[model samples]
Target: MEENQINELVHSFITYDYNNLSINTEELDDGKFFSIATIEKNLGKQIFTPNFEAEFKLIKAISHPEIKKI
Candidate 1:
């Protein structure tokens, strides 16, 4: 995918919280990329999971088997 598309996906993932948050990305020499984000909450400490809704949407978009060219 294009760089801009990748950036947009990353932005959507990070902003899923809808709160004041920040995400940072790091690229390793091996060409792998990872992201870290800080989420501010008012409640006590709790286990949190990364939101993958946007990613799932992307996957579903590309997984359609009818649109094929051979």
Candidate 2:
């Protein structure tokens, strides 16, 4: 695939999947917060390589501060 095509593919996938995911937060006894992402069981299997996982983590971490405010 061309570079632009790959970029568009990744962007579309992230936007769609992120919208579909369910995020939950909890307050720990020590006054800290814990957050998690959950996917519906009926959503079907996801296929991605380790690099994609790393990229997703990076994106999530970068936006965590803003996300925590919501």
Candidate 3:
């Protein structure tokens, strides 16, 4: 993926996770901010497959500002 696209993807995931978390702070805890390490952990042992199309769709969905908190 392109650098900008990658950055956007990372930002989207982090933002999404942050909004979902009950507690988001600078300190690392069980609710640490979604980060590269977190992404890597979740992607453990999986091959890196850059699917631009799906990624674009995911970014649009995750970064939607109207996503209601529940």
Candidate 4:
């Protein structure tokens, strides 16, 4: 994040233990005001795959042109 620019952070997980993995903050080219992360789920031993596509999609859908407190 840049100076004086508050970045909206994002991370997703299946549980508080974080058995599923959380994504790192990646600034998307779509806009500077928004960011993205890809969460991974553990299906089985040593198996990891994308898990929060729907949630991320909803986030993307709800992104605002300007920030607001609620």
Candidate 5:
């Protein structure tokens, strides 16, 4: 995949998790922002693999300015 596409995917997962936790940007630490270590620690060895729907959702979400900030 392209670099931008990959970045969007990662961002989407981060946003999803953050929203689930009801966390705002100010409350998020550096470790929680696109850190592989944090993802592995929180998700427990389950690496993120985007399926078709997830890919679509990520693409859509990342394109939106509001969602991208989260």
Candidate 6:
């Protein structure tokens, strides 16, 4: 990833197998979007890593309080 790259975190709706999960991000400043580059079985493992986990937590933290939690 480059210094100008901004990775938006996705909040998976989270079913038993992540089958019903949705990966998305709000329309960015330039109308660009990004989500976690995750594989189904590896979803959990990916989110557990320091980098992705922290970014996800940060996303949740900065999100509007009323619209948080899915």
Candidate 5 or 3, higher lDDT: 5
- TM-score to native of every candidate shown: 0.21, 0.30, 0.21, 0.24, 0.21, 0.29
- Which of the predicted structures, 1 or 5, would earn the higher lDDT when compared with the native? 5
Any residue pairs clashing in model 6, and if so which? none
* Candidate order (TM-score): 2, 6, 4, 3, 1, 5
* Regions more than 4 Å wrong, model 4: 1-51, 66-70
Among the numbered candidates, top TM-score falls to 2
Candidate 6 residue-wise lDDT, 1-70, digit = tens = 8999766654432223445544344633332223334322344665354555665566656775643443
What root-mean-square deviation over C-alphas does model 2 reach?
A: 14.3
lDDT of 3 by residue, 1-70 (tens): 7666644232234353455566555543433344544444454344333553355346556664543221
Residue pairs in clash, model 1: none
RMSD of each: 15.5, 14.3, 13.2, 15.7, 13.3, 9.9
Candidates' C-alpha lDDT: 0.33, 0.40, 0.44, 0.37, 0.46, 0.46
**lDDT (Cα) of model 3:** 0.44
Query: Model 1 residue 16 lDDT?
Result: 26
Candidate 2 ranges with C-alpha deviation above 4 Å:
1-36, 39-47, 64-70
Model 3 is weakest, by summed lDDT over 10 consecutive residues, at: 7-16
Instruction: For residues 25-44, write the lDDT of model 1, one tens digit per residue.
Output: 45322222222222233112
Question: What's model 4's lDDT at 6?
Answer: 50
Choose 2 or 4, whichever is better by lDDT.
2
Candidate 5 per-residue lDDT over residues 1-70, each given as its tens digit: 7666654223444353544554476855532344434443444333544443355355646565654443
